[model samples]
Target: MAVSESDDEGSDRARGKWRAKKKQRPFWQELPILIVIAAVIAALTVSFVGRPYVIPSESMEPTLHGCSGCTGDRIYVQKLSYYWGDPVPGDVVVFVGPPSWNTRYQSIRSDNAVVRGVQNFFSFFGLVPPDENDLVKRVIATGGQTVQCCDDQGRILVNGKPLDEPYVKSDFAWVSGQQNATYPSGRVFGPVKVPDGNVWVMGDNRNHSADSRAHVSDELQGTVPLDNIRGKAVFKIWPPGRIGPVRAQDPQQN
Candidate 1:
């Protein structure tokens, strides 16, 4: 009788342990569902909403920089900045350009594309992936306006009004673009009017950027169509040392 009773107690103890083990393994069983939900949420976020963008160029200079140059690291771009209004002058912006930038990224990467996507997910949350590449530059002129550089007093002019460009050249170098370039190169413009739905843009580092000031094929030059504007870059939020409001170039300058 004693032996039989002892055997029954051991059996009960084993059953208890089995139940405990099952409870401990709950997350493993539910993991697939959890992953599915997470993936669905991510897809929606990337498709319908803002994804964090990383700057990877010096095209914006004092405004933004990517790892490709001396500017340290990446930043989170608000993809919805243009939903309320068009890009205005002095607004920093990001946009996809010609294959010159994207092709180079493809040539260098060797990792699996899925892994890259996962890394980007972490970047979307501003958590990891300390690197990115999106061009950032300041907008200079909006639609239906005339932009010209070098007033009689060494300032830029927009629609016959002089802009107070404290962030740009007071006597900043007026480096000209290619001889036939449509941008305001070397203070050159026969008063070309920005088209009805385009905005003229120039980098704060006017001499260097290949922005709207750069060539957009043969027919359209000097102005970027409104649809091409990804979003207006508002401020620099990285490096933790330099952060402040991106000031406009005195829109009231007349």
Candidate 2:
């Protein structure tokens, strides 16, 4: 029969090219492994589920602003909120520099300490990308807690109470409207007690901050030691219509 209909039309054209390569071979090998597992789960949800910061400085005014001296507010830094404890009292942080303020926002991957220890271990698996010269403040007393500056409406007491701070900077408070304010007079003097571990920061643009009030060698200092803090400032993703959520102004004490 014409060689059995040409071997049954060459076995039905080799079974329709083996069912079109078993249906396009899993849409091209699982589309690049599902795009590298959705880019490592969106870089571990932007490294520890929350990231974005862009407030160059104005220290944090009326809750945060920027641009008169440059580098103003554009904040968001809440990587799993201190895992569950530690930095409190109006918390707004982003720290990891005690080689003396590590050269103001000095990027370029912190001049590679083996790429900052493999970007702090894949920044805990966001797969890497973080460290913007580092320095962002807020958190007015922790550890042994005492932080003082003024009490009678000159405000700034914490552990002695009085912290209403609507995000100060419209005639400052937290004591320097006559605190005898002679820093280095006792090395960040005052009722300043926070020690036992460390943590006592301030800057709602307190008259244009110089945090911890000058003296880590006096450049722009104000006691920050809880291992140079590194977390909190819950949210403010970015101008995609002012994202949302940002907390830590004593959100239940630390």
Candidate 3:
């Protein structure tokens, strides 16, 4: 059957109007929903999967830098790694500082409620550093193992054997005896045994780090409980040149 010209023209106009209305819907109307979704995903990932941590001090130098007055490496610490297993020797990790360890670093907190709230909001998504009382170091000795300073060649001894410690800082001044006059003193610490459920940690930059050895007088005797550990540091994700896996060295290889 033949359709009337006027009728066909009316149908075409209706289709065009529908298309225009669809295009006219404001994109801003959907923006808030998208932002909420993104925030939820970020929050979940940070809480359960991983998060970025910026090196804040030179304690873990050469392996992970936080040198004073210099930019530090940004790494992703896997929050779920320790869920199924405990932190073993040679695993770089992040953990909450013990009360005894807390005195070493000055707290950086704002008394203003608004400023503190703002920082807390961003921290939920791993956008900023965690609290000042958090620290990162390599696991040197697990429960039941002994950790001591300085073998015959200044290497740390673990479980009655000297560690290879290829990652240790070996700069000219350190090797020449001009440096390392204090901390790594050839026989500075005892052959202390790690207590059950705790792990002894130290920084790769021995001379510069205030680690387990420095906190021996504390109640935990310089060891952190496994429960205090946040997770293992797995990757360096910043500074293109330094991007790579944060190696977990095997004690057996040394």
Whole-model lDDT values for every prediction: 0.60, 0.63, 0.81
Report how far off residue 104 is in candidate 1 (Å).
8.6
Q: For candidate 2, lDDT tens digit of each residue in 1-254?
A: 25688898999999999999877766688899887888788777775666656666666675656666654555667667577767767777877545555545455455768968887766655555465456677777777766666665566666777667665655433444455555433222456666666676766767666566554343223466766665676666555555566555662232
What clash pairs does model 1 have? Answer: 55-66, 56-66, 92-233
User: Which residue pairs in candidate 3 collide?
Assistant: 57-66
Give the per-residue lDDT of model 3 (tens digit) for 100-172. 8887676455679899888888888877666657789999889998887555555668877888777777422
TM-score of 3: 0.82
Tell me, by lDDT, which candidate is best. 3
Better of 1 and 2 by TM-score: 1
- Model 2: residue 81 alpha-carbon error in angstroms: 13
Error of 2 at 223 (Å): 15
Give the per-residue lDDT digits (tens) of candidate 1, residues 9-92: 999999999999877857788999897788778666654454545665555555554445465534445557677777777776
Q: What TM-scores do the predictions have? A: 0.65, 0.34, 0.82
Off by over 4 Å in 2: 1-21, 24-28, 35-37, 40-49, 52-76, 79-91, 95-125, 139-148, 152-161, 164-179, 184-212, 215-247, 250-254
